[model samples]
Every structure is written in C-alpha cells, then in structure tokens.
Target chain A: MEIDLQGIVVIVGNYGSGKTEVSINLAVNKKRAGVDVKIADLDLVNPYFRTREARSQLSEIGIGVALPPEEYLQADLPILSPVVAGLIKNPVELTIIDAGGDDAGATVLATLADAFNGKSVHMLQVVNPLRPFTGTVKGCLKMRNEIETASKMTINGIIGNSNLIDETRPEDIYSGYEFVKLLSQESGLALKFITVPSNLMTEIDVSRFSCPVLQIKRQLVPPWKKAVKLS
Target chain B: MGKVLMKGNEAIGEAAIRAGCLNYFAYPITPQSEVAEYLSRRMPEVNGNFLQGESEVAVSYMIFGASAAGERVFTTSSSPGISLMSEAISYIAAAQCPAVFVNIMRGGPGLGGILPSQADYLQATKGIGHGDCRLLVMAPAGVQEAVEMVMMAFPLAEKYRNPVIILGDGLIGQMMEPVEFPDHLKSEPSNKDDWAINGMDTRKSTERNLVKSLFLDPTQLNDNNLILKAKYERMKKEEIRYEKYNTDSDYKVLIVSYGTMSRVCKTAIDQLKEEGIEVGLIRPQTLFPFPEAAVRETALKEGCKAVISIEMSMGQMVEDVSMSLQGKLPVSWYGKCGGDIPTPEEVIDAVKGLNV
Candidate 1:
C-alpha cells in the first residue's frame, strides 16, 4: 500500500478541492509511519488556508514544515521565499508542495525551472465531483491544462478528493471514486489517492481502493463549529 | 568517508544533509539548480524534507518557519534570487534564527547572464537587507572548501543563532573535484524547546512564542541593533579567518580575493612566482567578520606597498580593501562583471599595472 515516495509530491487542486488539507494530512500520515516528512507551503496565491497555517500542529507531529518568511505570511506580494532553494537542497522524506488552484495558482512554479532541471516531479491535481471543474470531463481537462501550462511542470497524477465536508456519505464516495477513475483514464493521469471522511471510513469498502485513501480532518474549524465541537 | 568526486553544488547539498539540516526550502536559480535537483532524490532516501518553493522570496520565509521550530534548516539562491531573499535573511538575522544559506553567486543587478561571477560581494558582507543585520559569510575557494564550509555552517549557525552564508561563485558550483567529507561532523538534531515556537509543551516554558521581524519602537530596535553590532564586533575578534600565501617574503604586490576568485588569485600568484615576480595573496575564508587585523597588519608591513582587490563583480569588495588599507598602502581594484571570469594571466597583467 506504500510507495517509497522520497521525492517531491506536488498537491494541486481548485480553490475548494481541499488540496492543502490533503497535503497536511498526507504529511502527518507519512511522518507517523516512520517517514521523515517536510511540507513546503507553496500555496502562494491563496492565504486563507495554507499548509503553513498548521505549522504548530505539523511541528508537534515531528513533521518539518518550511514556510515563506513571516513577512510574506499575510502579504499578497508575489515572491517565492529563498527557502525553496533550501528545500531543493533539503534531504528529507516526502516533500509535499501545496500549490495553488488551477493554472493561475500553479503558474508560479515556472520561476523554479532551474530546480526542476533533470528531475521528475509529480504534480497531482485534486478533483472533487461536487466542484464545477469535476462535474464534466471537459472541465477536468481544462483545469489540468491550465495547471500544467501554469506550473511549467507536467501533471503526472490525479488525486480524487470527493467530499461534502461533515456530510459525506458512503454512496457519494463510491460515485466520486467512479467519476475520478474515468477522469484519470481520460486525462492520462495516474490515480494517486482518494480522500474519505474519517467518520465514514468504516462504511466504505476500504479494500476496494487501488490507491491509498487519506482521511480528511479540517485543520481550521470555523469559530461557530469549534464551539459545538468543544462541548 | 572517502574522497568522492562531486560537483560543488551537489557537495553543498550533501554537506547540508550531513550537517543535520533535514529541512530545506528553495526556488531554482541558474548555475545553482543542480543543488536542488540532487537533493530531490537524496532527501527521500534520508527521510528528509525537500521542496521547490513558488519563488526565492517565499523559500527564505520557509527557512524561517523550519528554523523557528528549532530544527536545522537551510536555503540557496543566486544574485537575483538572493536579492529576493534579502528581506527574509534580515528577519532571520534579527530573530537570531540559526539558518544556513548558500549563494552560488552569478552576475548582475538585473537578469544577469548565467555565468560564474562574484558580483554580490557587498550584498554578502554589508548586509543586503535593511536594519543592522549581519550574516556569517564563509567564502569557499574551491569544491572541497564548499563542502567543508557547509558542514561547518550548521554548528556555527546554531551556536550563534544567526544566519550563515556560503559565498561561492558559479565557478565552484560548476566545477567538479574530489571532496573528503568529515565523518565526525554528521550533525544531530538540536533541542531548541526554550526558544522554538513549538506548540505549548509543558516540558518547557509556557510563554507565548512569537517569531516576528517587527519592533515598533526605534529605541528598542536600536538598542537590540547595537547589541547585534557588538556581537559582530566580537565575531571579528574570534571568527576572522583567512589564508596567507608567501607573506613571509618582501612581496611587491598582495592579491586580495575570496571565493573562486581567491583560488584564481592563488593560481596567478603561483604563475607570477614561477616568473621571478615576487608576489603574495591574502585569501579571505570568511568574508563577513572579515580578517581585518590580518589585512591591516599585512598592509602595514614594510615592502608590501600595493594591494589589489580582484573579484567577479565591479570590485564590490574593493571598498573594504580601501577601508583596510587607509593610505598605509595604495589599494587598487580590478574585476569581471556579468558572469565573466578573469584569467590568471589577466590578473598578472592587472598586477603588473599596479606596479607595487
């Protein structure tokens, strides 16, 4: 069930596809499984939800997290931190870069053409059928083209992140898995992983999934929901 | 354990891993991209972290994050990329976050050509970013030094809680040579629970941990700045390191250079010596916390009347030489900018023109 993934694993998805969430969960899961994991917060276009936002949690779990300098934390200024150079030199297990949504967000990787020289990087586009891009085959291809052209690094895999937040059902998971399987075949992207609601894991036929299944837990719960869960 | 033939850029990458810098972030820049490409696969074997960031600007910040958590972290870039990283390096310096950075220096103020050049001398030594910040600049003269200096950078950074810059021009980065890695220097993880912003662990202090660059009050910032300056001054007394060649003899000209340029100077000096032209060289191993006393003493010595500062930039370090000489000896300058490397024969010609 585990591939010796010691190189760069880029996580890409549309705005609400939960790419960062998947990245965070994957990093923790790998690190807990005795892998030396480091997460690069490459999600520059979006600020609200970034892999770095869970710095404290990642650090606590023995996962190294490289974030852009604190000055760029909240600033919308377009500058990749020098830490990327460091990351390229870093010798760690499972370096997951949380890239922004679509081509606009992914285009930033073009600046790093030098580092990608002679190296094969896996850029996985996360898909959610509930989202506009995932509802049709053409929409998925359009998103993939945008990301590939923007990143300047090819998209080698597809991550199916089907969910309805806390309301995810087992049937919905089966439907989503099928939709992504078709998308993966059409787009020629290897079906990398499928994400499932942690509570519904017992309901689904976990053994049926050919690739790994990651459990998604919202790192950032809204204040209203936090109070309800707090009790 | 054995001397392996490796490129300088790859050596630096391996040395950082040996130094226990398991966490790294960076964006790719020309001439130094091999460092990133090498680590991408090596990190996985070691179970380390390697990430190509959105830009050099964000990569430096990522170093800040990893280092702030008390883990050994590092980043690398070139001239334009380093320019983007200056802002974060300043913050790392001020916060006293022990981080390592390698600048495989290339040419220019803009999109300089991708040739070997040491055009970033002033930026490396004179604090590229704002405020009274300083970095420990270690200049590697060749591939071997590049590997050794990186191994040394980790402990030095941790001990001082400061950022260390490995200044090697593109020549060293591109050149391949045999490097013997020190077996004893494989670094271990440091427990910075006292200062690191690790989430509230009761094993240490419960105070709020903040890693920010802002200090609103001028006086408070000024007072801290003064302390930092004092630290730099103390560093001069302890960390100022350089290599002296043929200074025992009454040499007519003294060549001053660092990084790959210094190696070139050494070659030129050897060539001049073979030709019966009495000359010497002062190769600065540490650019910042410079070997000021050595320069002053060497300049003051009788018969060593002229000093020439040769570099890949338009003589950025020449200003420092001017300050070091201070009329005691006539200090001149010569350089090749925009990625062009000066030949040993050209340096000899420049030396003849200086007429020490």
Candidate 2:
C-alpha cells in the first residue's frame, strides 16, 4: 500500500511508546520515497533514543535532522535550535518532529507554537497499547487530552505501534490495531497507520488493517545486538 | 528468555523486578531516569508498586518505609541526587534495613554535567553518609554485568541486613547492550520475617518490633556502632569480588580500574599486548569491600613494577589503590572528570608513558 505522509507531522506518545523508532523510520521511509524530508528532534526530556542519535544515518539518506548545539547534546536542559522553527515554518516535502513522551516532553512544543501557527501540522498520538496508562481506551484518550493541553495543539490522528521487542508477533499487531481503532473513534481522530516490523509484513493479513502499513526498520537498537533482530 | 538489546538503566530496572523486588521508589534524574520510567510501566503489569517521589530525599525514605516492612525495594539516582539521599541512606544502614540502590553516577561536587562519569567513587565508598556507615558497593563493567550485579544486590543486602549499592557510570546507564536475563539470577527474595516490623498482627507474635536508627544514649550508640563495624568486617571477609586480566601471567605493570573505566582499560590492555607490552588489569567488582588483597597480590608480583589507577574521576579510586599496595610499588593515576571518558588510545599512551 502507498502511504503518502506529508507536510508537518508531529509524533507524540507516552514513554517507551516507540516514538523515536517510529520517527526515525518515518524519516527514512519518506526519504526513500523520493520526498525531501527534514526531522526535528524536539525531545528535551529523554537523553537516550532521541532522533539526533540517528543523525548520521538520516543524513546519509539525504534527510535533514536539526538538533541542539553540540555542547547541549546530552544535557536535559531544552536548547531547541532556531533552525527548528525554520524547518517547521518552511518545511520540505515532509517535516517530522519527534516529540518526547508524556506531557513533560510535550511542553516544549509550546515554544514552537508561533511557528506551527497556520501550518497544516498533523499532530498524531502514537499509541503502544502494551505500555502502561495507554492500555485502555479511556487511558489513551486521557493521555491524548493531556498531550493536547501541554503542547497547545490538537492531535488529529492515531498511530498504533505495539510489540514485545524480539517477541513481537502477528497477533500483537492485529490486537494493537483493534485497541488503537477504538482509541481513534473515541478521540475523533483518523487512523494514520500501524507499524509492523518489515519481516513480519508478509505474515499479517493486509485486509485486516484499514490504514496503510508503515514497514518498520528497527534502527534505534541497543549496542549489544549487532543489528536489529526480528523473530 | 532470549537475548534482547536494552539500555543499561532500563535493563537494571527490569532486572530488579525479575529479581522479585516489586516495590520501586525513585525520583527522576538524568542518566538513570530510564530506570524509574521503565519501572513505572512494568511494575503495575507485574502487580508491583512504583512511585516517583517528590525528591531523592523523599524517595530514600519511601524505600526505607517499604523495606522496613520486609518488602524488597529499590531506587536509582545520579551523583547529586545520591548525595541528597545520604542522610536517609545512613539511617537505613543504621537501622539494618535490607534494600538495594543503584547509582548511575555522573560528575559532581555540585549539580554537575549529565554525561558519563565516575566521580562518585569516593562518595560511594568512603563517606556516603554522615556517620561511619558502609555500603556494599558493586560496580559492573557492562549492561549484562550490571543486570547480574543488580540481581545479586538484593540477596547480599539480605545476607548482611544492610543497604547494597550497584555503582555504575552514566555510560553503562545510557548505552544499549544486548543482554539475557540469565536463569541463574532469577530467584525469590529471602524471608525477612525474623526482624521485619510488619506489626504484631502481621507477624502473629505477641511482641511488637521497632525498626529505628535513633539512639540518644552514648553507650548504646557506641555498642550499635561496634556491632555495625563487625558486620562490615564480615562483609570484607566474604563479599570482596574482582576480575584479573593477564594478571595470571607475571605481567610488567598492574592497572587498577572498575566500572566503565575498567572496560576501557581492557581494550587498552588488548592493544598493548599486541605490541608485546604484557600489561595487566585488576577490576574490582565490589568497590566498598574492595579487592584489596587481590590488588596487593597482583601489584606485588615480582615482574610488576608499578600500579596505575584509571577512572572517570580526577583521582578518587587511586587512594584505594595506593592504600592497597602500601608503598610496595609506585602507584600512579590517570583520569578525566566532568563527564569525559578517556579513549582506549589515550589509556595506551598513559601506560606506555609509565615505562614499565
């Protein structure tokens, strides 16, 4: 299926919701699709697994990545570069901002409120039903409301991403689809897409999903594994 | 379970839960916040309790309260936060409460930078708290070893009825490593019924138990101190752990290192050996009940001329290395503070400069 993701896409979720992995993969996917892509790492909370960690890989793919200064790279203090506003203001074919998880990380978006004004930004709440607080439809809606309030932006779409690391299965994707589908209905948001590991793509029934499937290449891996391992 | 890649902080948190520590109380701090974030999710799924306390000081007491009731509990923090909890840590030590604490240490004297550092070496071992209290500090070189050490921390704490610390540098906490939660490390916590203060109803005993560190009487306090001293002595006898690389051979020089710095030393040692330098390393796994005997024996080797202490701190662990050798051999130091780790090549240069 052809998934044409465009314009300014802001990805936000709770902690460990695979937002960074999704953002990294989205940038690569969009770049491979022959679109000009630039990703902004607005995650001021988490020091690990930020989009900037994959800066070299993204740059190699001809995708632009804006991050804090070299000195403040590892600091928890928020130091959003001025270029982030520029990227958001005059975005490429597709500009993705990988936000930090939870309200604490989403608050940084408030600083970019002016730049995002009058822009067709598809603020999507990425939901991993496996994580805490988002396990139920009510829980997911509450989190969505919290993120909207904190970022001063409305989330217009839902992205279902659920897996148990190397133990992920076809059923996990299908079950997670059902959970996020309910979340979409309750929150009055569109179902953007569900991510499946590239290897597991053939195992799942494409007809089971109403939205396009984004083939995920696990890039944000821990160092112990030589490469991303898919069961 | 099969091997999976995980960050050191997240892995440590999962290891604690897998080790049957269901209660976690900690405040969010960099280089170690993933531990709290991971547990905040996993704990509820496993029917465990997790809390993000207002501050490190409050979290320490929360751990103390849960542990006092005979529950296995733990917390994680960096240098400045750990220093904030030192008062409660001393109380937990004096009260003989068995709990685990993980310090993914960063550079410090104040609110230092948040990169990888081992500046807490002195604070962790020598003067963690105000009183003459000691923590059984275990340092792990990698994420896998960090997992094992955290799993073992609970049992050691119970065995001696004292607080045990898993001391790791921020690199270990931040880096991703492929690790398998070994089956051998998975076990139930020991019974704390003998001394726990779970009230008379819960214990089903006529006598009530009080767990407190306060003793206003001078003579009684001294006796308590003596008893604590004896337990520390027992730990020194039984809990010392170290790893020797190339020390089995009559190597020319001895390098003392621990935690993440030890791994760097190992890399340097490998390169030096390629050039036929024959340098050796002694990595102390337990920093408090330090491998002093192992260090002394290795340093006193007939062919070993000098001992070098390499750490992320300016020169903290060097004191321990110097004290261990007792002037039998010249003790030297090389380190970088404020979240800067020496590269393997720099370590090689230092060893070559020693002219061993």
Candidate 3:
C-alpha cells in the first residue's frame, strides 16, 4: 500500500503525542518504497527519543539525514544546521522535519518560513486524543491555531495517532480516527491518515478506514523495554 | 498494587492531586515543565486550581498565600528557578506555613544545561535563603518513591507547619518508570484552626489569624527563632529517614548517596561484591534531617574502614557525611557536575580507589 505523503511533511504536535515516532516510521516507510527520503531532526526542545537517535539506522538504509554538528548533536540548544535550509529550498521527494513538541518547539520552524514560501510544504498537526491538550476538539483546534501562529505556516492536514505506548490497541486507532474525523470537519484540515501498529494490522479491518493507513513500526521505547530496529 | 508507566514530573503532579492538594502554582522550566503542563488540564477536572504564575518568584508567593489560607498547595521548578524561589521559601519557613516545593533539579551554577544534576544539595540543605531557615528536604530515588515522597511532604509540612521540599534530579523528572501511588498515602487534609488565615467568616470565629513572618520587636524575633529551632530538633529526632543495604554484613567501605545517584551506587556495590569487595550503601531518603545517627552507626560497623560520599555535585553531600561521622571515620568523595552523571563503572573505579 502506497501512502501518498510527499514534499516537506512537517509534523508538529504536543509533547508525547508520538510525533517523533510517527516521523521516523514515515521516513522509513517512504524510503523502503524506493523514494529518495531525507529526515531533518529540527527538534530542539525535547532531548530524548528524537529522529536523530535513529540516525545510524536511517543512514544505514541510505536515507539522507541532517543533524546538528557532531559536538552539539546531543545538546538541546536550538541550533539548526545550514543544510536544513538547503534541503527545504531544493526540496526532496519526501523530507520530514520532525519538529519539537508544543508551540514552544514549533517556534523554531518559523526561521524556515521564507524558504518554504510557495513550496509544497504540508504542515501536518499530529494529534493524539489520549494526550492532554489535544484530547478534545476544542483543545485540538486551540493547539492548531497556536502552532500555525508560532510557525507562520498553516496546517493543511491532521494525523491521528492516539496511543498509550506499549498498551495501545486496535480500538485506539479506530476511536482516534473518529475523533480526528470530527476534528478535521471542525477545523477544515484534511485527515491525512491514522497510524496502526504493523503487528495489529491482521486484527484491524482495513476497509473501515476512509483514508490510507500508515503502518507504524514502533521504534521509540522506554529504556526498560528491549529496543527493536524498525527496518 | 497496580503499576502504570509515568514521567516523574507528571507522577509528582498526580501524586499531589491524589494527596488532596488541589491548588498548584508554577512556572515552566525544564525538565520539570511537564508537571505544570499535566496539572493545567488535570487540575480543573479534579476541582483544583492550577495557575501558571508570571515567574517562579511570583509562584512561590502564590503557594504561600494559598497555603496560608489553609489549602494544601505546591509548586515545582528546576535549579535556577528554585534559586529564584529561595527567598519565599525562607519566608514560608519563618512564618511556619504548610507548603510543599518540588525541585526537579537540573545542572546549574547560573542558567546551566538542562540535564540531571544533584548540584542543589548545598543550596537545598544548607543555604536555601537569607537569615536562618532549613527546609525538610526529601530526595526520591525513583518515580514511585518520588510519588510517595510528594504525598508525604504535605502531611509532614502540616505536621510542623513548615515548608517541605522534594529534591529530585533531571533523570527522575525525565525518565519513564512503572509507578504505583500507594492507597495508604492518600491522607486527610490537615486542619488549620489556630494559624491559617482562612478568614474569620469561613471559620465562624471572632479571632483573626495573622500569617506573617515579620516581627518588630527583637525579643519577639528571637523567640520565634527559638521556636523554629525547637521544631527542627523535633524533626531531626523523629523524622530521620535512610535505607541501608549490605550494612548487616562486614564491609570495607560505606557509600553515602541519595536520589538517583544512590541507584547507581547500588549497582556499583553489586559489581564490587562480585569482585569480592564487600561494599555497603547508606541512602538518605531525607536530606535535611540528615540521618546522622544512621551514618555514624554504619561507619562504626566492624570491618568498615572508610566512607565515600557519591554525588552529582562537586563534593556537597560529602560535608554532611563528614559531619555525620564527626571525624570518627575517614571520609572520601566522588562527584561530577554540570549535567554529567557518573556511570556505574566510574563508581566502581572510585570504590576501588578508596582501598578500604
């Protein structure tokens, strides 16, 4: 199944909304599908479970990755590499900027507004109904406005990714789809897709989804859980 | 009983709410911002008041006001932010108000990096504010312990009518762990008939209550200080908390540590045990009440030759260890600061360097 994600997909969400995990799996999925993919770790607020943590695997798979300088890579300062500007200007078939969570994190994306002007930039607000601010339609819409105001970019789509880490189930995806559907109709943002664990796909009815399903391979686990490579 | 994975900051917030503390005032600072964010949505649902004050300084006063009015209240901040609230902490201590302050400490001298550090040890236990005041400080080693400590902080604060601090490092704030808030720790709210400024109308009494730290007369101020000192002595006598591991058996050295650093020491001790070096640990769950007697007795244990204090700060807790031992035993120190957490192997090397 070809998920039609293309051209500078910027994923923004509240913290713990699973935006980073979604960004990693989306990059891997499109890369495996033979598209030239590049993921830029622009998250400067959160210090853990970022796209850069999967740099070794992403680079090993020939997916282009842009990160901070070698010395400042692990640091949480808001230092954006110059190459990120070049990537946004030149454009790849699929470029995923896994932005930091919350409006505080999305403020960094405003620096690239000029480079993304008139370009095919799909600023998608990833929503998890399980999280605090995005659990209701009103909260999600308030966050949508905040992200757009902070980034100086409009959100064109919503990606429902309601989950409870390892405790997530098939019903969560279905329930989240309904929640985000009403959110989409209320906010006028397209319902891009809802994510389902690849292992739970056999148990989920694909025909129930109106939009394409992004098969998520869990890559971000707590330190106690055994780490698994998505690819 | 049942366990749920939670971030330390969120867990502390939930623990406070579960402990009947409905008023929360805080300003966001990493890595403890999640606590404020969690309570913003949660407080209203539980009929609690959650406010993001203009600054840590303002929030500290907000806590003082709410707590003075006989409501259970708390606030959380990081290192520099805690430093900003130190003045208010001192005043709250002086006025004998019941409030809890949580410091999910990060690296600091100034606006230090946002990583785990125990650098606030001296600031917390020794010199939190101007004049003379000491907080009942507790350091939790894990998420579950943090929850339990936060729950205990309220009752302990009301028990003595003083400010209590839950000192945690960034690791405890950022890491996710399975935690269960004990059912027994959910305590009834303490009554405040004598001192709380809950207004005469609310209490339906003719007598007005004053909750101020100021005293014009020098003799009155001295008497207040003596009263506060007596309470400290009582706390030291009744509330000293520490855990001993491997101290029952003969050991060459005793390791003194607290908070997340203690867990690292436990692992290092296990590794040392495998190498035939018997090492024990004295983890002080409470920092202010200092567990001095426990340290002295552990140091006096037969076959214990030396004591080493392990911390993330540069030799802060070691002074307390030396004070506890009272020069009876030789004391050494191992520490790292500025967001650098010492590894288990590094701890092992330090233990070996002690050489009994």
- On DockQ, the candidate that comes out on top is 2
- Runs with alpha carbons beyond 4 Å of true place in candidate 3: A1-7, A21-36, A47-64, A68-82, A107-111, A117-231, B1-5, B44-47, B50-54, B178-189, B204-207, B244-251, B267-278, B298-304
Candidate 2 off by > 4 Å: A1-37, A48-64, A69-74, A94-96, A101-231, B182-191, B202-208, B246-250
Candidate 1 chain A: 10-residue stretch with minimal lDDT: A222-231
Please give the distance, in angstroms, between residue B314's alpha carbon in candidate 3 and its true position after superposition. 0.1
Residue B9, model 3, lDDT: 86
DockQ of each: 0.01, 0.17, 0.14
Give DockQ: model 1: 0.01
Looking at model 3, residue B157 earns an lDDT score of: 92
Off by over 4 Å in 1: A1-231, B184-191, B200-208
- Docking quality class, candidate 1: incorrect
Model 1, CA-based lDDT? 0.77
Residue-pair clashes per candidate: 40, 2, 0
Q: Rate the local accuracy (lDDT) of all candidates.
A: 0.77, 0.85, 0.86
Give per-residue CA lDDT, model 2, range B1-356, as digits (tens). Answer: 44555668889998998788899999988889888877877888899999889999999999899889898999999999999999999999999889899999887879888888899988889888978799999999988899999989998998888999989988889876657786644344455765588766756556666798999999989998998899999999999999989887668889999987887888888888888888889999999999898999888988889999998999999999999998899999998987767878889899888986
Q: What is candidate 3's fraction of native contacts?
A: 0.02
